[model samples]
Target: MASAFIGSSVKTTKGPSVAGTLAETVAAVSRWGNQPSSEDVEEMIRDSALARHAALVKYLENKLAQAKGKLKKVEKALAKVQENLEPTELPTDLETISDEERFLFRKIGLSMKPYLFLGRRGVFDGTIENMHLHWKYRELVKLIVKRKNIAQVKHIAISLEAESGGVLVSVDKTTQGYAIIVYRGKNYMCPQALRPGNLLTRRQALARSVELQRYEALKHHITDLQERIELVTSELEEMEAGKKFEVHKALYSKFDDGSIPNEDEEGEEEPFSEVEDPKSEEGKLEGQSMIPADCNLRYQAL
Candidate 1:
């Protein structure tokens, strides 16, 4: 019967848990009467291990492919972000340059033709005529105007030293259109045209004075605001700290009861005895004697 069973097992090798059943199948193939061949068992184990490794390798290859795809997506996303954040360059035409160099020389020459006569004599002057000259002279005139306006607006003035060790007053509101000469504690106003020096007009001096006053006021206001902000900030910090301490104290004392001994109970005097003790008969006798003596003394006084 055992031999018959072995033969049946070997004949029907296909079953669940095929790898585990292979050992039983091999044993049955040997008829349970002899040992199985080592070469066949070794070959079967090698084939099973190779199949598992092949499946693992395929899974890893799929994972590697997914990782590469994800990396490519991330790189593309980074590139898009960088492109969006990049700064734009300004147009070349918007850049500042010398108008004389950019304009046609012929146009400039034609514009200056009318002014050529003015240029021949020193009395004739050159003003901003062409675009090139306008570009250059416009800013220069604007700066000069600004300086003159400042000198006129300011109440105070500045003086320049002349080559002859004399002083030239460039700006003075009281001494208008003239350079003031200070000598021997006296001022002598000279004609501005004849003085061969620059003079600031009244408008320019006043403008500068107003500008300086405004600047000083702004600085003072800023300083005051800063000081007030600091004071308020410090007070707020102190208040917050005090509040925190109060909250902490409340929390710490939450479990404590409010019961306390009264002032009278802490150090109170005993009341007079309402009833005499029976054990102190001597005290009762003395009380009775004192009452009788008091009554006899009251009768005698009456």
Candidate 2:
């Protein structure tokens, strides 16, 4: 008799499950009796297994093709991102550079033309960019990069000679911000993300130090000159005021004090004067002496 459930296994060569009748069972039994030999069944099973493997291999091949296509697309996207991250193409015309570009170059230095290129845009506008900001700005490397435009740097470091004190500014093309590595002590540093580091190398530190020293010297000199000018101005004003006062005093003494030679007492022993001479202490100025310091007088018997 046929099993109640026939063709239940869809994975088998048969289709969906079906109910079997007695007549069907009898026919199945007859076919089963006339079925192929055991050797033939074994061969068929082996062939079926091989066919399944072939189908699976076909499916895997299709999947692999799809994966390859997807990988190609991913590679394109990655390439685009990398290209954007890379430095901008150097403008061909540095000599005829734009006003903005020239300004940026001048701000850094005139010699830093080689490394200066119209870089990939930042959050702000402007084409010119600092190449070393992507890594480090070493004085020696800076010179080289200015000429060669290609140099490898390991760390975004800034070193000062004798004593290590300087700022390290690093700007990687990948990151929006640069790092500021300030040397606190002998072997410690805080790699803080903020303003650009002062310089990436010792040579820059030396140059910067010299510049600051010169600036300080100039400032001091200016201050000294200002002081001297003020001192001289003060002396001049005092002298002018004293001269005006002395002239006024001489005029007043002549008119108001009546300290003129008298015609009636032409040979008078005592000089005629409305104001009396006052006694004076040594090194002290007496008030209303009624006679000028340079005045000459001749006295005779009264």
lDDT per prediction? 0.29, 0.31
| Stretches of model 1 off by over 4 angstroms after superposition | 1-181, 184-192, 195-197, 243-302
Question: Clashing residue pairs, candidate 2?
Answer: 133-171, 134-171, 168-197, 169-197
- Kindly list the per-residue Cα lDDT of model 1 for residues 130-172, writing each as its tens digit: 2123333221110011123433322111111111111111211
**Regions more than 4 Å wrong, model 2:** 1-33, 87-302
Query: How well does candidate 1 score on lDDT at residue 167?
Result: 19
- Tens digits of per-residue lDDT, candidate 2, 1-302, equal 24545545334546654458677788788877866888797556555543433443344344345435544654554344333222222222211334454334323422222332211111111111132233343331121111112111111121111012222222222111111112122233423432333222333333333444344443553454344445434433554354333333332322221332233432223332333222221112122222222212221111
Clash tally, candidates in order: 17, 4
Residue 179, candidate 1: how far off, in angstroms? 17
Worst 10 residues of 1 by lDDT: 293-302
Measured against the true structure, the TM-scores of the candidates, in listed sequence, are 0.21, 0.23
